[model samples]
Target: MCSSVNAELLVDKQTFTSQNFKTFNGNNIKEVNVGWESYGNLNPQKDNVILITHYFTGNSHAAGKYDVADASLGYWDAIIGPGKAIDTNRFFVISVDSLANLGVGDPHVITTGPASINPDTQKPYGLDFPVVTIRDFVNVQKLVLESLGIQKLYAVVGPSMGSMQAIDWAAAYPSKVERMMSVIGAGQSDPWTTALLEHWATPIKLDRNWNDGDYYAGSAPIDGLTASLMLITQNALSADFFNQLGKQTVPFQALESEPLHDIRKSHSIVNWLRSRAQARATTMDANHLLYLVRACQLFITGHQHDFSKAIASITAKTLFLPATQDQLLMPYHAKQTHQALIDSGKKSQIKMLEGPLGHLEGVTGISQHTDAIRAFLKQ
Candidate 1:
């Protein structure tokens, strides 16, 4: 089925700007802009629309080739094409770059974050930018859709943090969102998950070069940013997968990287992770990562403090797809949320992705459950 997915679905980034947008916290941003991408066609009734919110590190490119020869495809290419689970041929698939998206340095990504110029001061917002929330993200997206005269959504789907947004949608807008597929999702950020998210912000703050998120004009916290990225990558991966890769670096092969050889030296695995992070960081901003972390840490379904009351607003037929070996969010995270939905008398289903890849399995091994997803969408 994956092989049957066409790689020819090319797309371009478009910008949406909402003026004097007031955040949920009562903070007003002069202008908020974000990039979005869409595939397939929107029917005249405007009812066949599916919004795919992206994961932590992902952008608006959910399923398409920016360029045909580009080596990488959109993150969910396998299930989003002509005859795939999402089947673009029959549905309009759209994805938007999140507020304070990490990919600020990427040419295709347009986001309003710490690095964007503050119109009032003629300089980058830096730390002056107001803190944002998951609610703000959904509101901005609502503005974008409203701009296109689109009302009501066929479904909202996402993975990880995106799943958080999807659930938020069904809760905050019960009458609008018809279906929701939350992959690696939870109903709320528990104390443990909240604490883990704090760790991601800590690394960026500890970097001496961070300057309290004012490093835009300076050297930038490359070290701290890379470390933060590495932390997220490790947390998202399974121990067995890391161990398998770590074994490739034997004692002798790690000689130069051995601390015995030099205090700065480290293992090949460490270097490999750092290198991978460095590549991603080139197009990422540290402040944006911090802001995004806080957004995630503050998230709860419907943005309500009461758990039971929060999910009470959901009217969508929901599906919870958790990675079987996920070490970061863990299967139990999804389980608790799924049980809550059932207890609340909401339509909900749970399915586990079986694989050794852990959190990554939801993306890499998703095709294995195509029938399940396809049927869920059909219903």
Candidate 2:
């Protein structure tokens, strides 16, 4: 395991604000603040900048400890360091929190989500927050780069939802992105993926305390949120891995007069799942999860429904890394995107990652592909 303490790691959360930010739906917010963090230094040429986009539940903390005594490092700490895959010695790595990320409650992350107070109404935006898309996320990231005096990115690398944003950057601003590494992400959300996303939000919407996303001040929809997260966690890992983790199948039984007796008879796997889900539920806001889910649902490159046309606009050299066991975003999704780019006469390639971690293999299994990633970025 990689140590959480790294002397070279520069950990600090920074903020960027843009006034009159408009969403893809044409709704506008008075202003929006993006939370971000950086590692290494930008060279004088400013061309050594590498942007690392975060996954659905991730934030700007991409590769470091927030403090010396911190128990954990950032999400991609395994592959990013002074001389690791991304090579901080040769490039500046920057990561940013997406709009309405899971970090709504974290003071370190200054993002505009449903949990944020609306400037106009002087209350939480809740369901009133404008609908945001993948393109919208990329657009805001572009502003962050521009503010930092970075005109062109050496590379834009990300996994899952972050990968969607990487593809968007290459398509929307071809001249700005030199290379793109899209890991376990698709050009557009297929019907199956869209349906899954809908299911993820269903439980939250059904919660009585949800009150149509207006439960910020009252009892949060913890039960519904926990159920939703449990669903997500199940898909995030492979069946084989879960089985190896001792997950056993248990028959459902309706509780009679003694409800506690039924709970005592529950399988260990059921209890484990509930424990994990409840832990996540306590940290993340239900409304923020819904917003992020909707954002993922709307993901599309170049805002084009046709995959070929969407990828046709990409001028960056791209590498598609698909996880073979990914139950959520399958390898076929990444393969299809790569095929579309190739058919469009764009430079692209696909590399399949074999692992037991399923969708999370993009992150947990990333170390296995560091050499390939390093070579591609060097090109």
Candidate 3:
């Protein structure tokens, strides 16, 4: 289990604003804001900066302790500290919250999602918010880097959706990125992955309260959102890992009362999973999740149909880490990306992370590959 730390570290949230930012769909917003956090100090040359993109439902709080008595540190706290994998002692790590991110009421995250109020009508954008792509996310980060006077980045690293952004960074701005570390991510969204994303969104859209993404003032679609999270959580872990979780004992009895009959549920596993899913739904907004799902569905490097041609433009030295047991984002996808990059005459390598945590190995099982990652970054 991950434990809380009482370390005194400053995690500052900063915002960057751009005027009339145009998205991939040719729609323009008057102003766009990106929330970000920085750890460690930048050297005089500013060349030691490393950008860490976040996964789905994650924000800019990538590492360090938010409060002295917080339950747990940042998501990547295990590998990003004074002497950890990325080593804040020698490198300055920066993380940015993507547009339409799952804010979960975090005041520091200033994302424009379905729940955000539209400046034009003073009402929530909901479905009115223009669709965004991975390339758009990379472009916003580029603006942030330039605003900070950072001409070049030592490395661009991320896991899952974050890895997609990292790949986009290398392809979109090859000159600015020196290296890239993509974990449990692909160069493009394949048909299988796209189909999976569709299933995740089906439940949300089917909810009566969804109201075509305009369920802001009314009660959010907690039931549909919880079902979606449950599906994702099951795919995110290996069958064995999920089985272990299922076997754990629950404190509450599983029962349901109906008008005609009382249903007695004895399966502890189903009860546990539902409870966990409900807990996450309480904090997340359904419309924000739908927006992110659409973004992931549309993610493709270089916006090209040809995968090889898409990665041919990437000039950064790249490292691909694919979890061995990931049922959600299969390992073959990462292998295909590595092969495409290699065939394109770009420098790239692949390392399979052997673990039972499935897609979550990219985060929970990260410690197993820290040595290899540390060596790769040093190289």
Report the lDDT tens digits of candidate 1 across residue range 141-227: 899888888889999999998998999999888899999999987778889999998999898899999998777677999999999
Clashing pairs in 1: none
> What would you estimate as the lDDT of candidate 3?
0.83
In candidate 2, stretches whose alpha carbon ends up further than 4 angstroms from where it belongs are 1-8, 247-265
Each prediction's RMSD over C-alphas, in Å, is 2.6, 3.4, 3.5
Q: How badly does each model clash, as a count of residue pairs?
A: 0, 0, 0
lDDT of 1: 0.88
What ranges in model 1 sit over 4 Å off?
Answer: 1-7, 248-257
lDDT of 2 by residue, 1-379 (tens): 1232445475878889999988888989788998888888889989999999989877888887777877887888888988899988788899888998886777667788888898888889999988888888888998898998999999999999999999899988999999999998888888899999988899999999999999978898999999999898998899888887873454333443345565555556666788998987766888888888988888878887666776888899999999999999988888888888888998887888888999999988888898999999988
Local distance difference test scores for all models: 0.88, 0.86, 0.83
The CA lDDT at 266 in model 3 is 38
The Cα error of candidate 3 at residue 180, in Å, is 0.6
TM-score, every prediction: 0.96, 0.93, 0.93
* Pairs in clash, predicted candidate 2: none
